[model samples]
Target chain A: MRKIIFLISLAVVSICSVTTLSAQGIQEKSLTLHHGSIKEIHSTLPTCITVANDGSDAIEIVFPANVEPYLEIEIDKRDDILSFDVIDESITHRELNAVLQKNPIRVRMSTAVLSDILNTSDMSITFEDGSVGEWFQVINTGTLFVNGEVLAAKKKIEYYNTGTFTSKIHSYNTTILCLTNTGFLYTNGYTTAKYVEQSSTGIENTDLKVACEKLSISTTGSGVIKYEGTVDDVEIVSTGRAKILTSKLN
Target chain B: MKRLLIFAVSLIVAIAECSAQQSIDELLNREIDSGTTVFKMAVKRDPETGEIIKRVKEFTTTGNKQLAKEFVEAFESERDNVDGWEENRNGGVVQITAVWVNPKRIYTITVAGSALSVFTQTIYREEDKKSK
Candidate 1:
């Protein structure tokens, strides 16, 4: 009975996690990018636990940087898989072939179970194609940040709603970068126009300005924010000074 | 001329160092502009190593069926609310917004030279209701 109940919960969680994988009408159960990569990982993994999805290798569970990762199913089992390692190198998508060869594991897409993936890993790499390849990672909304300023008392922040529904602002000024239905961030200037409320503007997103400093930006509502481009280093420097450059990415 | 050359080299090194100091947002914006649907992005600061790590994942969509509505009058239509809220389809170019859906967390997204960077700040109340 315990095993049966666990299976039922896993099914629900898997349902929420799945989306369309291709245009050929093929439905994949659980997928790890490296488990399917054509380039071989060269067997760098210390140990690989293999589980098959249908007939093909569905998932490759390995830690490229060698770190301890814990998977706790929030809904069903408290712990089903657990391993800890000391990380040394960084994990990148290009190394998928090397890692998967040693850790050819699979994701069990059966039922709904609450699981939060926690890792003590150190590094990740962004590919030239703009895609970030992460190891021992699962995606979910977590926290907010502040840049372009020291992130002190009363920093300016603006929200631009590009999406339709007005973003649901739980509250404002009270949080680090004031989160809503769309995006997250932080600030260090003072401005009253910084409205983080549950309601939203009309179909079009409005540009918000707090401190002439352009402390923060948002898309939780329906608009876009235009500001000078500054890396984190520059953002942490003196405020009020704006930058000018015709910035474009290829 | 000698002094000018030395000053210019120092300035170049400083700028190069700053650019290499890419944050979680810069790396992410780079991926999103290339047509990746960034679902969730997180940052962690290690007290031991003092290294901050940013992690993100992208997924293809099947177009969820959000609660749709109808407008009785043409001008008073709330229909566009659902059609083009998160993504815009202009003939061919599909421009998608990178968003943070977590409550109390504010995310600022910016784009520069083919790269997009997002910084997040969490909102909390002094009285402390929840999500603090």
Candidate 2:
């Protein structure tokens, strides 16, 4: 009877240890949306996220097996809108792929993630709505399309469009570094500073309607910039018949 | 009796200071209505000092121009006590920047063209002065 009691205690200890080890390994979470639209998907740190339209009714996220252990996903529904927040707890960088339906879902991320993914391989994302946050630093070597707001508050958000880049940007206090090779950018927002550097044989057209405190524009080659807003300060350096058009904001 | 009088005065002064200094969250919640949709609110801190350097808040009113107008007016009322205040209006867009000295912070408010969205940011004066 004594030997049997010792054996039973050892078995209980072994089972508890295994259960604790399993809990510390991989953490997976899921939520199925029955109603409401997805308002935003926000990530705490810079993460490599691939969003693709699968034409499904429900939003589904599939994490790669290798990096699944380091991600924490949370969904909050308030006032008939779903807000998805992702926190990346990994010290090392890893790729995350998410497939969802195209309509009524907005994905927000730092432009650094897009730059990282584009550097590794070619990626194209087509969705209904998307937004780029404040800390954006991207050098695009491929086609890029953004049909949403590019917001910056404290630091200057920089983007080097060196490929076929097209965007309808509502910017705030951001400096778009350069636009080269088939770049078409339409901007309308509040800007403290704006720098436009256009070059190459490809025509770069920038239409800006902004309430700007200052604007410093430098254009070369077949580049044209149109401006219409209340600007406190303006500096323009143009070569090769580059046009800068300004009209009063009505 | 003199010591008791001094202690009472000290307690009153401390309470007044505490009531005057309101945090960013408290200030916003008190000024703005709860029905407004809060899009995002984020803060950045100094890594070394663990001091909050910046606070940003974005919200949409869903085409409620009256609410947006009221918010701008509420900030404008405090212009007399601020260190610096400036208001700019270009067509339907309005931008306001105010610098406060007590907490040493700067506030920037922007109301979009349709008055459907508002973005506000508060930055520490020390950080702003350092960048300048």
Residues A73-138, model 2: lDDT tens digits = 443334222222233534332333332111111233222212111321122333232333334444
Per-residue lDDT tens digits for candidate 1, residues B1-132, read 999999999998666434321333343344333322223322232334423333223222122211000101211232232122243445533333323322233333333323333344432222223312
lDDT of 2 by residue, B1-132 (tens): 999999999998666444432443344553332222333444555656545576655555446666667667766766655677888888878888776554555566678854544455666634654443
Residues A1-250 of candidate 1 have per-residue lDDT tens digits of: 5544332232243444444333334332342321222111111222222222232423333232222222212222223333323123455433543443443222322111112222212111111111111211122122211122111123322332222222222222312233233332221233233222222222222222232211332122332222222212111111111121102210
Error of 1 at A81 (Å): 57
Q: What is the lDDT of residue B74 in candidate 1?
A: 16
TM-score per model (chain B): 0.24, 0.58
On the 0 to 100 scale, the lDDT of residue B39 in model 2 is 38
Per-prediction DockQ comes to: 0.02, 0.01
Model 1 scores a TM of: 0.18
